[model samples]
Target: MRTTKLPTIELSLVTLRSIQKKDFKDFFEFGKDKETTEFLTWGPFKTLKDAKTMLKYIYFKRQQRNEPIGYAIVSKETSKMIGTIEYHTFNHKGNSCEIGYVLHKDYWKKGIMTEALQKVTQIGFEVLDLDKLVIKHLRENIGSKKVILKNGYKLVAIYEKQHFHTKTGQYHDVFVYEHWKK
Candidate 1:
């Protein structure tokens, strides 16, 4: 096994760095928003304690693992956490990983996520030396589809009933996208 570290990534509008305890408030802000957590697997935090517990788990994983699994997406101007992006899954043997992210609803469709995704994918390929990167979004998440396509990820597959939606209490199809290092 190879150990890797998450490098701080700076972009024109945002900075991607390790999540910190100080970011709990911002984390809660987005995590508690139903619209923000709509397409995500977990969230819509019921209370500050819920947010704190989740943040603690993230930090705990970082402490125990050899590399970071997630990052806080901070706005450069306000220095506030507006989102999170992460390589949630890794396959060392295949040199590949699956990436995921979420942004505050207020920041949606503003190109912030597009910029962040571009930078993070670059990190996955250039910094982490990954041969391939994958991302999946609910079929209804057109915004995510656009971001994925804009970043040059190709639609590889659509799995039926691939995800269980907590809010809807039903299964939904998922669109899988992929980018291969050239």
Candidate 2:
């Protein structure tokens, strides 16, 4: 697999940078909210310890393993980490990988994620020189669906009850979308 070193990505509203130890407090800001994590697979952190442990893994362990890492989405306006966007579950042999993101509930409905994804898409296709990108979202996550569409991903497949959403305590169908290098 190709190892990655994340760069600081500056967008109009947010900056995508590496996770740092001190950013735990910013993550805790919205991470403690159940509603914010309602559609995701992890987090609604109850304590700083939880945030700390997760940050440690993102900051340290993934690098050691040469896993495909991601950027922490920090707001330029507030200078705080409000969410993250990353390439995960890499399939190097196929030259494709999945993209995922989460934003603080307070910043939802704005065009922040859409802008961030556009740049990431450029990096994925040009910097990384990958053939395509993949993304998935739960069937009920209309917000996520919108972001995926806005970023120019097209519906490629659907699976019945693909992911068991621990946040919502139920199985949910998943929509798989792909955007090839253009």
lDDT tens readout by residue for model 1, 1-182: 24467788888788989788878889999999999999998889988888888878865475566556578999998999999988867676788889999999888988989988998888888877889999999999999999999999999999999899989999999999999998
For model 2, the stretches where C-alpha displacement exceeds 4 angstroms are 1-3
lDDT of 2 by residue, 1-87 (tens): 334766688887888887777888988887888978877777889999888888787645767757645788988888989998887
Question: TM-scores of all models?
Answer: 0.92, 0.92
After superposition on all C-alphas, the RMSD of every candidate to the true structure, in Å, is 1.7, 1.7
Query: How many clashes (backbone atoms < 3 Å, residues ≥3 apart in a chain or on different chains) does model 1 have?
Result: 0
- Give the TM-score comparing model 2 with the true structure, all chains together: 0.92
Assess candidate 2 and give its lDDT. 0.83
Please report, in order, the local distance difference test score of every candidate based on alpha carbons. Answer: 0.86, 0.83
Count the clashes in each prediction: 0, 0
Kindly give the stretch of ten consecutive residues in candidate 1 with the minimal lDDT sum.
59-68
Candidate achieving the largest lDDT? 1
